[model samples]
Structures are given as structure tokens and as C-alpha cells.
Target: MTMVTPGSSPSPDPDLVQTILLSLRRKQGTWVAWAQGCQTLQQAKLTPQQIFEETGFEPIQQNQIVVAEQVYQSILKAGLSDKAQAHFDQRGSDLLYELRVLSQADRARVAEFTLKHGLEADEVRELVKPVKEYSYRKENPPGFGDGPGDAIAFHFWKLARQKDDLQDRSRLIAQGLRFADSDGARQQIETLLTDFTVVKEQPAPTLPLYRLETETDLPRIIPVVGQMPLTIDDLKAVPVAVPENPFGMVTFSGTGAWIAVPGWQVIFQSEDPVGLLTRARQLPNYPAEAADEPVLVIVDRANREWQDDGYFLVAQAEQLTMHWSPSPIDAPILGKVVLILRPKRILDEDYNRQPWQLDE
Candidate 1:
């Protein structure tokens, strides 16, 4: 009976870890105890796989329990009602896990709402997203308060207003009514449903499907150039490497080229366009053809509007380079990166070595 006080030491005692592992196999503890044991095992530098092999808990299950335990502790610290505390003393690990993304105060409030409604894990999962998003808003929308129901009502009300179709508006309004605690919140949604008149179907989304053949519908090839200051003539002089696939094979021969993707219509429309050859190793997590093989990154010189998620070409300290950011970079603008080319995987590399082994 090795005694281990939880959170007593940053580095857990080895004997305590062994005791917890043994207890886990016998199924002799609550989820909270198991969570603390898993956390202690992790603190002892045990890998998730090692812990999984020692105990029957999978990595994801271990993660859920650890996070759920943390959320439960926060709820307790926030001072829950006695009945609410009792209700969650042993159960609701999955529901609590879903509340991990929320703030401590919000977690406590949502916990009580969850218990009051007797919410299943799936419903709690759906409920948490709106509550988290509502907290980010600068001001609470009209007819909504700081309560959990108000957050959910605000979410449904916003959706109902966005929809032009009567069916969508009605459905969203119904959802608002189901969770809304205040009279003001319900009144606003009821008004919206009663006033529903016009109906417009959302436009069908277009599928990104393109047909490619050798001669007629071949992809345009854009050549990779060095990171140098470019003039209009240099942009014009660079040949648009049209596909020279003679025998049903696209061959990339001299001065590495990337087939122009149909998705780069914005790049095509640019007054001046050039491809920048970037070392794939330089970009984090980008797969490289070879360790030194530079890949073609197409940029549109005209489109320099800063989008948060977009990658851009910038000139800093007299050197042209690629930059990606949600915030503005303190550098002169060159172009917006529109396309990055990754070479197709060579699936027949083994076949090239062993010519007659087609049975594989």
C-alpha cells in the first residue's frame, strides 16, 4: 500500500507510480484517481505508449481522463452547490472533458446547466462550442445575458437571422426556444419565426473537379526562378513551360517546373507573375522531394492584399523571401504566394529496381 499524495511533487515517486499502475490493473479506483495516476506516470517521463501497455487505457482515453479531472477540480474550486458536487463526484468524465476548452468560471456554470438538464455527452459536446464562442464577442447581443442558456440562445438566434429559408429559420428558432431561460431571449426568436416570409435556397457548392489529358487539356507549367529582384521583362522572358508529354508521360526536364494548377486563376490574372524556387527543407512540415531539392512556389505580384491565413512574398533587408502570418510583417511587399507544388509520390520506385515482380 504505497501512499502518494496527489500534486505533492513535480517529479512523482517511482514507488507511487508502480502502485498506481498495479491499482489500475485491478480496476480499483475512481476516474479522478486514475487521471492523477496517469498524470503522475507522464510526469515520471513514461511515454503514452508505455503507459498504455502497462495499463489497459488507450492514449486518447488517458487524455480525456486527465483533462476531465482538471476540469472537475476547477469546478470544485469555483464552489459548486452541494448537490452538483455530489452528482459529479464519480461520473460525468466525458461531459467534463468537453468543457476543458472553456474558462474555469464558465466550466462551473456549464456544469450546473448540464446537470439540471441531465445532458448526455453528445448534447454537452454541442452546447460547449456556442458558450465558448459567445465569450469572445465584444458585447452580448440584445436579449441575451451571461448565463449558459443565454449563450446557447444567442447562437441559435444568430443562425436563424442568417438564414433566408423559412425551414432553417424555424428550426433554429425552435432550438433557441428549447434552451433559452429568459423571456427576452425567447421573445426575440419568436418574433423572427413569426415574421419569416421569403425563402431562398443556398447556392449549390461547385466541386473542384478538372479533366486532364496529354495534348488538349494539359496543365500549364510555370518555371522556378531564384530569389532575385525581378523586372517586367524578366517576368515576360521566362517561358511558360507547356507540357511536352509526347508518350503519355509528363516529363520535368530542365530548370525545375511545376504544372500550373487550375485553382490558380488569380495568379494567371496577375499582370506580372513568376515562380520562386524555395528549399522545401526551409518550410516547417512541408515534404521535400530531396533534402536539397527546391520546390516551385508561384506568386502573384499584383495581389498583395494581406489575408491572415495566406502566405506572401516579401522583400526584407534587400532579400526576397516567403512570409506567412496572421499579423502584418514589417517588410516591403513583393507578391502573394498562390501555389506551392509538391511532386507526386513515385509509387513505382521498387518496380524500377525489380522489373519482373508485378505480383506485389
Candidate 2:
């Protein structure tokens, strides 16, 4: 590995820079290894000033060196001009400061994008900056859930993932970033909701179903299909037990209590959250499905005893995005209607069901 020192002229060549930066990790193993060295020298009675002066290395936070080297590598891969390269070396610490928020996996991905796209070092830093909530109703496209969003509108713009008019919808949403918030640009926000893939409901759940029985002392338990627009609170409260196995859950059935249903993963996302609960309350109280034969019930708007029209359920199937949970309360709030897999039939002739995971 090449020696890199302060005030030394750094190479502009992308390949050379990447090689030297990559070697930092291999030789030192990880920033933690360097930290261990610091502790060891101190244990040997070396003073902090003496250690830095003699050993020629200062103690660094875990991943600090890793992040520094990573920044150098990204700068090289970005193929920025010489001035930009110098800017990166000078601002290396700032880039690291910005990257502090990313997980190891996500930080690596940002580096990968830097390498792939040849973004300028500064641009690369800005690209991974986490997007906070920027609400633009009607004209806005989407908000990344839970985790931070990438600042690159191009990144999310590419999420259209299919060829359709929805591509325009995505582009329009991205537009909100540049134009929507500006004066007089509010009219440019696209009000038309893009139609994602229309979900198809299978008559039976794809997985095998074991009867989930409620305990005698507990409240009556019933299992509802995800096609029913149940909220996150409702799904978590579904009498499914804390799973002993990845595919196991405690549930209730008419004939027994504390029933164990294997091969079911409880997961969720909210698509049409506003009306989800309202629809659920109006649902016909059918035995969720026949015992031993789980069936799919797409919970859109259902009619109960009423003479009303245009009544929207607070929580309904149309608002769901994705849900695949085994236990309960663990489903991710998807914030909008997407698609959910309702496993109506999760078992077979021999009474065994291998859990099937549906990637939403």
C-alpha cells in the first residue's frame, strides 16, 4: 500500500487511489484493531502524547479510519477533477461526519454507487444524505419509510420499476423536490394517484393453516386475512402467540385454546391507512376461514347492516401495502396501499405446511 500523509500530493488516478484505500482495511483489519493497538500501548505505560509521537498513529473511533479510507476510495471512483479530489481530501472529515448516519450496509451501498456512477466526491457525499419527511400531498411522489431517504432524486425516480404511465407519476413526484416547494409551483404537484400493480387475490392462502385457538380465559380470537384492511394495532393483537419457531404463532380456534399455527409470517404495510379501520368494523363476522382450510378474503369495502353509500372505512384493504408477519405488532407501516399476501391454504394432505415468504 502507498503511504498517504498530510501535505503529500495525492494521486488523481481512480484505480491507484482505490487500491491504496482498500489496503487500509486489509492491513489494519478494522478501525477496532487500531483502537486495540491504542489500548495495548497505553497498558504498556506509554503516555498518550508519547504514543502519538512515537507510534505515528493517533487513537481513532471505531470505523473512523474505515470511513476515511472509504471516502478516499469513493473520491477516486467518482473520477472528479483534480480540484474536486483536493476538495475531498480537505473535506474528508466532513464527508465522514455526514456518513455517520448510515448503517454499515447502507454506507457500503453509497460507496458502491459512488464507484458505479463516478459522481464527484462532494456529490457522492450529498447523494447519501438522509432525506427527512418532505410532505407534498397530491403533487408529491412518496416518502421513504422509517429509515432516511437518499438526496438523489434520480435514485427514487428510478423506482418506477416498470413501464407504464406511472413512470410519469414518479417523474412528477421527483419534480416536487425542485419545483413544488418553490413559489407558485404548488399547482405542479401531480394529484393523480399512480396505479401500482393491481393485486390479485387467490381463493386460498398459499401457505398451510393450522387452527389458531384462543385461550379459555382470554378474549375470543379470530384470524383475519390481510386483504381485510386491518390496522397495525389490530394485526398485532391477533391472538397469534409469540412464535417459538420462525414459522410458529399462538392463535385461537373455535374448538381449542393457545393454538399453534406454523408456516405463517405476520407482516404488514399501510397503503390506504386513513380508511383501513373503518372498513374493518363493517366486515361481516364470518369465521375468518374454515379450520384446516384458510381462504383469502380481500378486505376492501364490505357491506354490513346499513343503507349508506360512499362510506369509507378508516382502515380498509385498499390502503394496505404489504403485510407478512408471523407473530403480531411486528408488521411495518407501509403508509399506502400496495399489495399483501393472504395465505388461505397453508397446509396439505399430510397436514404439513412449509412457510412461504412472499416478497412484496
Candidate 3:
């Protein structure tokens, strides 16, 4: 792959790239929403240009710009040099994304937090605390409704697939849904849930097995993509970098591998769950595969996070019994872990996707 240096211009427009990406994402989301019956078209059949023109774009909050103005005013009041204000316009939005949530009332706490953790999202989150009224309340006040109704609607709609009985695809694609105010408004949601089938409930594994690997030819962590595992043989391992302090979140690629971290492992994945089990059976020192029913082998020993009787509600399964637990083997030198995947929503046959297989 060819490397492009910083500030180098590409042949294509950057704004166009962002627009195309945005449109594709919107199309995907809309298709999913239509399948689940969350959206209804506002108008009848229209041309492509009309659809684009009529599509609802959210009002620009200009939050970063507003915060930038406030900061500039504060800087002027402090009698800071003009040079400080010059860089503010370009860098102000960047600072707003990191530090805008800081409460003006808690200036002391904000200073302390910024001094310790720098101006980052984690610092902003750390500095902010729950409202006192909600913190230790025994019961919600009268007329206090549940938060995140829209989120609930979105999640439900995302996971569901349209029923075969439903026709008029174009209408669904264009119409805006009348949210549940009365029974008439709620009919679509009710119908969708009743007709749609969730697919993640069916996994290839019939049984969960706790197997003990007792061999010398140990399995190695293989890199499918470029991502390498964060390996650790020590339980008390500290992050190599000083910036990963307090409540910092480090986002990393989870390439399929038998990764050994201080507390967790990134197990291997396959195109199909059956293929994954098949490969695990072939590995030396790994336990033999189960007969008749396919088994998912989990090796557990010397790990503090292991829980035998626990279950987690995963996105695919959407049930409490579909939770995650550690593997059966925990040998740092001779153990490999198979990746466990959460269930994904089943989409319409017309809207199905295939994983891209690049040359190995």
C-alpha cells in the first residue's frame, strides 16, 4: 500500500467523500428502519433529486462554534495576547469535542481534573457527576417517565426484519412514521414485532463445553489482518504509556487471534462458527470435539474473571442466557482461545450482505 503524507491533497474532493459516506450510511440505516417499520414516507413517489431535496437534515446546533466564541470572550477578559486568539478558531472545535461538557459552576473540580488528565473526553466524563436528585432516590417522582424512548425504538427497529406479508416497499422507504400517541399510531410497531423474526437465537454450537487442554505443541496467535495482540503473561501488568491513566478508553482493532492480555484474550474467528469449531478440534493439545452435537470449548483456570453460572444479554441473542464467560484453559504458554461472536440481526433476503474475502 502506498503511504500519503500529512497535508497531501487527493485527486477527489474531501467534502464529496464525506457526503458519499454520509449518504451510504443514511441509506443503510433507512433500509434497516424500513424493514423494521420505524419509518413511513412523508410524500408519494418522487424523483431522486426531489428525495434528496426533501430529506430531513438536522438543524445545525453550532455547539462548537458557540463554545469557541465563549472561550474567545473569556480569553479577551483575561487580557491574553492576540496570538492566543489567532489559533482559537481552527483548534477551538477540537477543544470543544474534548472539553465542552465541563460545568462552569465546578471550576475548581474542572481545573483539578484537567491538571490530572488533560483536556480529553475521559476527563470531561470524570469531571461530570450524576444529579443529586437521581443519585440515591428510592422511587421516581410522579409523571417521571423512562428516559431513552427513541433509543428503545431505534434498537428494536434495528434488530427486526420485515415480514413477508408486508408489501408496498417504496411507500415504506419514503413515508415518515407517526410515532405512538394513540393505538392507530402504534399499530406499525405492534405489527412489525408480531411478524418479524430475530435470527441470532440460533448459533451453530449446541452445547458449551469446558475442556482441559493437556498437550505440549501449543497454539499460536495468528494475525489475519495487520492487528497484533496485546500479549501479557503478568496479572499485574500496567499500560506501557502514561496517558492511559484513571478512566481512559483505548480503542483498538480486534483481529482474530489467541490474544493473552493481563485480564482478557481476543480469541480467533472464522467465516462460519462451524469452521471455527472444526479448526479448534485440529489444534494440538486442544481437547477432542464433541460427537453428534457441536460444542464450544472454553478453557478456564487461573483467571479471576471466570464465571461458570453467569450469562450476558448479547445483541444477537437479546436474551440473558446468551452472556459471555471465559475459556476453560488459561495456560499462558500452551493455550489458544477461539473467538466467541455475539449474534447479529437477520435482514431481508434482498438486503443481505456478504463478508469481503481478500486474498490471504
Candidate 4:
């Protein structure tokens, strides 16, 4: 054998070493290099081939040494196994299984813990997007015992008693009336009666009393009037007209002023023939005194030749010749002439009147 050089170092490729170690760990069910292999190497001072032989690990092929060197460098970059060991310890293999098997009590405990840690269930559920349906159901389980209405009534009654004012108490009674069933209404009424009765039954101081009159008599009375009969001729004498110009003068002659019948005219030798004929159709009757007066007349001169006639009398006036003007006229005329008549104030007269009666 040739004499070997002392203190000469051999360069071992890191990739080749890591590949060998990884194969050995997989086959042996452990990361042997990082655990037993690295420890043995530090203590024994053996070459890679010697270590493989001594540990029963296979030798890496010469062609695969570069791949092994790459893997070895990666393993070194990933650091130690202790960090991984700590992680596995904290989150054990059965974490998901534990969550799956959790009871209602366990879920409540989790919810409480989350709340204590400032992680609200409502907020978390909103964020998670697609949460398991069962989780939501567990969080909001159905309530037990008495319905919501009873709780509401109890709180309302408590608040009413705290206020202790009569109006407040009355309002509470009204609210109870609105919500209560027949039996509940009766119960509430009885409760109120019992409370008030207790106060009334207790002894109390007396106050001064005053006596006042409570009854008196009052009289009722009605008035009476005498009746009078009227004839057709008397009714015809009443002044009535569908006035042409309500404010303008209406003049009549012959029997025109004495009869209330419509349509009569004055016959004067100098009068316009067309105007007289029109007037004959619109006049209201007046009495003997009015007949002697100069008649007030409204002229309808709309038709250029006076074909449109003015109002006229139905009957002949005995002696009345009336002249009317807005201002004073000479001896035969009058100023501001207004026809005055006593109104017939009979109730239901229009309803009772016949067609012939209207003409009368």
C-alpha cells in the first residue's frame, strides 16, 4: 500500500449527503441525519461511505450526487427539526377530529372563550363567508320555557310600578288591554282593583264637606198665531215679477199695476210700437193706488227697430200713471223710486202651491 498523506481533508458534496440522509430517514421512518445520524457522525468521525455502511444506509449512485447536493442545501436552509417538533405538539394530529366531536356544552365554552378574547361570534360568522350550517345552528339554538310575550308583559308591569303615577298606571292598563287575552284582561283588572281597594280600606283623616242643590224645575212654552184665508183675486194682486233690469224702472198702464200677472204694456199714442209689445210680456201687477202713479218701465231696445218688446201689465190700471227717475223729476214724476211689498212668510208654501196657484 502507498503511504497516505496525513492531515489531508476530503471534500464531501452537501447535496449528495442530504440525498443519502433523506432516503435513509424515509426507509427507517425517522429523519435519521438530523437525529441519530448527525449525532453519530459528530462522535465517530467517519466518511460518508463509511457512515452509510456502518448505519446500514445505502450508498448514493455517482450519477445522483448532484441531486443529493441540491437537497442537502435545501435541508440546511430549512433549519432545525425542533421548530417543527414544537408546532406538532401545539396542534396535535387530532385537532379537526376534536372539533367534529364537540358537544353543545363544548361549543358554548368555545363561544364564551371567543367572546372573552374579544372575538364576537356574529362578527366572525359574517367574515368567514362559507361557514358550516351546523355551527350557526349551534350558536342560535331555540329559547326555552315562557314565550317572548310574557317577558314583555313582566318588564312593562315592572316599569309601570316603578313610575307609580295614576296616569302611567292607566296607560299600562290600556296597553295590557290591547295585548291580553280574555283571561289576561280579567286578571289585570282584578290586580288593579285589589291594589286600589287596599288603599281605600285603610283608615284616613276626614275633611270638611259642603252641601249643594242637585235638582231644580224649568218651564217649556210655545207661541200661537191666528189664521187668515186669502182668495184668488187677492193672491193675484200680490206684486211678483221676473224683473228685466232689477235696478231699472218698470212702467205700466191700464190694468198692468193692479194684477201680479206677468206681461202687460202701456198704450200711449206717442209710444214706440215695438217697445210696448215687448213690455206687455214682462210686467208684474200692482194695486189701485200704484195704478194712479206714473209707471216705472224698463225698455228693451236691443233690436234696432225695437222688435224685442219691454215688460207690460196683464190688466188695465184705473188711474195710475207712474214716472220713475234715479233723481227727482217734475210734479208728475218721482225720485229714487223703489217698489216695496210685504213678504208672505209662510213655511212650506212653495211645496203646497199648485201650478194654478202660482198664477194666482
The number of the candidate with the highest TM-score is 1
> Per-residue alpha-carbon lDDT of model 3 for 228-315, expressed as tens digits?
4545534224323221111121323343323221122322222112112233332222345433332333332222232334322222
1 versus 2: better lDDT goes to:
1
The candidates, ranked best first by lDDT, are 1, 2, 4, 3
Q: Model 2: per-residue lDDT, tens digit, 107-140?
A: 4445444434455547645555323111111123
TM-score of 3: 0.17
lDDT tens digits, residue span 196-281, model 4? 42222122122111111111111111121223576777666644433333122233443542212122232222133222222211
lDDT of 3 at 255: 34
The TM-score, computed over Cα atoms with residue i paired to residue i, of candidate 4 is 0.14
- Judging by TM-score, tell me the better candidate of 1 and 4: 1
- State each model's C-alpha RMSD to the native: 13.6, 21.3, 26.4, 51.9
Pick the winner on lDDT between candidates 1 and 3. Answer: 1
As for TM-score, the candidate ahead, 1 or 3, is 1
Which segments of candidate 4 are over 4 A away from where they belong? 1-145, 181-190, 196-360
Q: Give the Cα RMSD of candidate 1.
A: 13.6
lDDT value for model 3: 0.30
Model 1 over residues 114-197: C-alpha lDDT tens digits? 988889999998888788657645466788888899899988887787788878788889999988888988887788866764
Which is the better candidate, 3 or 4, if ranked by lDDT? Answer: 4
lDDT of each: 0.70, 0.36, 0.30, 0.31
Q: How many backbone clashes does candidate 2 have?
A: 51
Candidate 1 lDDT score at position 197: 49
